[model samples]
Target chain A: MMTYDALSFLLKAVIRFGLYMLLCISIYMLSASLRKKSPVLIVPTFLSVLISGSMFVLYDARGQKSGLDHRAAVRWLCEKPILFTILLFAAAAVLLTYVTFREAHLRRTVPDRSSIKESIDHLPTGLCFYAENGRVMLVNHRMNQLCHIILGRDLQNAALVWDDLCGGSIQPDIMRLSTDSQPRFRLSDGTVWSFSRTQLPDMFQITAVDITQLHNLAQELEQKNIALEELYQRLKVYETDVEVLTRTRERLETKIGIHSELGQTLLATRSYLLDNNENKTIPVEAWKRSIALLRQNIVENAEQFTLQTLIQTATAFGISVEVTGQMPEQKDVEKLFLEAATEALTNAVRHADAKKLHISLTETADTYRICFQNDGKMPETQVTEGGGLGSLRRKAETAGGSMQIDCHPEYSLTISMPKGGTENI
Target chain B: MTRVLIVEDAPMDRQLLELYVKQSGQYELVPSVESAAFAEFCCRTTRVDLILMDVCTSLYANGIDAAEKIKQNFPQIKIIIITGQPECSFIERARKAGVDSFWYKTETAESILHVMERTMAGETVYPESTPPLQFGYITSDELTARELEVLREVVAGESDAAIAEKLYMSLRTVKGHIQSMRDKTGFRNRTELAVRARDCGLIIVDKETE
Candidate 1:
């Protein structure tokens, strides 16, 4: 009997512990699913259930071993149900604390709409939005101030703002906005405002900026440009005047040099006419009076100056000379031909006793020739080169040309020199 | 008597020619003209044996042109061109124009009447050379053609290398020419020679003399 009672007590304790374990497992699984929603409550809930179950098992085993009455065992088992209920209530309180904490965390992470509204209100530029229905959805403080300044009145809606700004001057429906956003609005207070709009799904944002300073700067630049153009025109006129003055001065200088040259010729001629041994009848005073008369009728123009001087000088010696063809543009080449002619004329009169002299100028592709032939006495014998003829030959050769002297039927000197485009020497 | 025509632009020069013609006693003064054009017309219209033509006149600058025209028509008239200008330059042109003689007004030692008498007796008279003109330390005629070539570039402010390339000469040759010119001219440097050459217009060769 004692063995049977012992066996029965052991079996009963095992059965009760197994049932408590089942209950613990069920609550654990149920709490695990709810733990994801309020994880902070999971540990406390699990500890309460484990403690209450372990206390019940310890009380029952002690009662049974001490051979306690069934009522005592029953009372010990009853304490387990009260402990379970108390554990359930503690789990409920833990879940409520977790819920409160989560709400506070969400409030910290995401900002409220009021903060965004406050930010837009203090923006530097004017900001406003219009709903798809064309109603004024939101506006900042700057936007209101822009409306008052540009429109000359407070406007409630974007349509009213457009009407006030354009003043029916531009058809808003037909005007291309984004591609041509340069149209600006001038306020009554002389301030300039440039507006732009961006379209969104529910509404469109409009922005405006004061551009009065920029407009003033552009106007100032344009005015300066006009002034600069006028100054440039004035400078061009002054440059032209300077060029004319320089040309006139050059002409005057050439004339003065020529006059001085003429004066010297007159003095020389007076000495020559007075030195005539055969003309003892002509007084020196008479020649001086004649030379004085020659200075008064000189040509003043520069174009005819040199030619005129030559013509007059040749007339004094009874040399009837004529020139044809365009004058050489290069002064040096022209001088070469003129010098050779003088030498030939000298030989004709001094040596050959020639009376008539004929000079002809002809030009080829590479050379210009001055042919000097006179109706003078041909040499009785072969003529040798003298100081004058030798010098003439050298001049022609040095200039890359040649000189030919003919002493046959006619006394002639033909000098051919290189034309223009000669190397600068 | 020899019929003389005086074409002089200057009043004094014409009177001087008139006085010379009257004093010669062998020639009679024709109507004196102040222009080559009037002289040409006179030679065409009237009998003129001798024409005393100043190279420059009021109507036409070059008496050589008038002389050529007159000689083409009347091959019998004698023309003498007288001027104080550098005879070196005008001699060839006067010779080609069929002038009988050329006389330097200031430099000629011979009497104008004697040259006129010789020209009438079928004589062609011209001076030996131009009056001597000095540039720097050398005479104008002393500058050789090659020296003048180097001097032009120096006056134009070109470097030796640039001158060599332009003239198709070596750098050493260009420098040699410059140095030679400086030595011959007694100039201290290239700049002095160049400036004097420019002032005197001595470097007359342009391109063909190269």
Candidate 2:
């Protein structure tokens, strides 16, 4: 019987040892649950309580079977079951308080990530965050507002909205749109949304701003610049007209001077011949010839100095002249031809000491040309434009024509003008 | 007989002068040339007592310039400078060139024969004033002596610096004179004033100088 009692005691000791280990395991599990604030603490606490109560029942059965000495030795474990359970509850409460303080400190140390997300969402500019997996992870309030304007709905289905904006399905491998490709979205309200994406390893951020007003202003400025360019072109034309008018005034002044000088000369000659009429020594034939010559010069000089007149005048100066073709009919052209002829004759006789002059008037499809050549002694080198030739060149150029001098074989003057006189100048 | 050298370019003018000299009965015609340089050469080679010089020779040697050279070399020979140009400045320049007499070809009250006789008799014949030839709004008398010289250079197509060098004036002075001329005549540019001055026959220069 005693042996049977000893075996039962050994069995109680093994049960108490297992219950002690289980209680330690329950406390460890409770501490872990307190850190997480999980509901799993209740299972560990119930198991500890049931095991402690069974230990109490096992202690009472051992006390009944054993003497008082053995009962006294085990009373500390058996009699204080409620207190131990209360102590265990107190330990759990302390752990819970410690965990609550730790959680409060942690909350104070780190900011809430959701608040950052909410801050970006409330920004005025459109913002969107894309995950590495190609999902639309976060969208700001402006982005949502943009979607509402474009799609007539909120961005709860942001992936579909993004696909619609892209005009195709999103590729799975691409985290976000390429940075080089700045895609733009034009909404129904005529607001232009230009997007730029910033990429990171795990995600990318897209920003959009409205540039519609700026774009319209730029277009308007471009049109104004074009108009300004056209005005500049017109000013160039007016400048050329001013140059031509200036030259014409000079030519007219020159004509007036020539006329005045010629009148004075003719009057002087008439008075000389008349004053010398009664001289006994002067021959009558010489007198008659001088009167005839004076009268012819007056008639010729008075009635538009023609090419023939130029020839006669040069011939009178002891220079031989050969002329071809008829003079131009236009009064202005005739005057120009006469002036040029006279000037050439003067240059030939005086400057070049020319004995023979050859003149030709040729008409082409668009031009009237007067060519005067003299067998004069010209310089071996190129001649600078003198006052006479310079004036002729300026007049010819102003009239939308040109004049050239050739001094190789002989001294020659070529004056070419438009037949119709249709020049911008 | 006083030998005469006629340096007129026109055949008619030359013939008229020939008749006047022959009619004078005391003068003999030397075989003449048109240019003044040749006239100078003739005076040097042959005996010439009087020279009737046309101011506008239309040759490299202007009559005034040729007269100046001839008078310098042959101071004993008398020269009568004649021109249709009515510029008072031309007479002054001819006087400076040491001409013996001055006569206006068309406007002179005295005949060429009368000027030649007076010049031979050792009288410095000069008109009181040049004939009045109207230009734009003024006559050639409106310009000063220096201004006339400057105008001739301008008509010769000389640049301002070249004109200044030829006239012994600063470039600024030359430009200032041109600007004043433009303002006086109401001409727009130098070319207009110059071209008009040349056409008026106010001042004659050698074409080679151009």
Q: How displaced is residue A248 in candidate 2, in Å?
A: 22
Name model 2 segments beyond 4 Å from true: A1-425, B87-89, B108-110, B160-176
- How many residue-pair clashes does candidate 1 contain? 81
Candidate 1 local lDDT, B123-208, one digit each (tens): 99987765555876777567666776677777666789999999999999999998887777788888677656544434322222
Candidate 1 regions exceeding 4 Å error are: A1-425, B107-110, B144-210
- Model 1 agreement with the true structure over A1-425: per-residue lDDT tens digits: 12222335566466456546644653664475364554444554455455445544555555566544345644454445444534543554454445445545755665668877988899988888998655888899988887765444665778656544544443222322222444476665667667777788888778887777987898899999999899768755854464345335434544554466456666666666778656444344444534554544644433333443444444555656666665556666676665565556556665666555677888888888788776767778777887557867876787688888776666667888787645322
Cα lDDT tens digits for candidate 2, A1-425: 12213345666466455555555655665565565564544454545545554554555465466564255535544455445644644554455455445555655665578767867878878988877555788888898777666556666654455555555433233223222346565555666666666786788777777777875687699999999789768645744464344334433443454355456556666766778755424344344434544454321111333566445545544667798987777665666676677667756655676788788999888888999988878766677886657867876787788999877666678999887674332
Mind listing the fnat for each candidate? Answer: 0.03, 0.00
Return the clash pairs for model 2, or none. Answer: A121-A141, A350-B58
- The interface RMSD values of the models, given in order, are 11.6, 11.6
Q: Could you report the DockQ of all the candidates, in the order they appear?
A: 0.04, 0.03
Q: What is the C-alpha RMSD of each candidate to the true structure, in Å?
A: 23.1, 20.7
lDDT: worst 10-residue window of model 1 chain A: A170-179
Q: Per-prediction TM-score, please?
A: 0.31, 0.36
Enumerate clash totals for all models, in the order shown.
81, 2
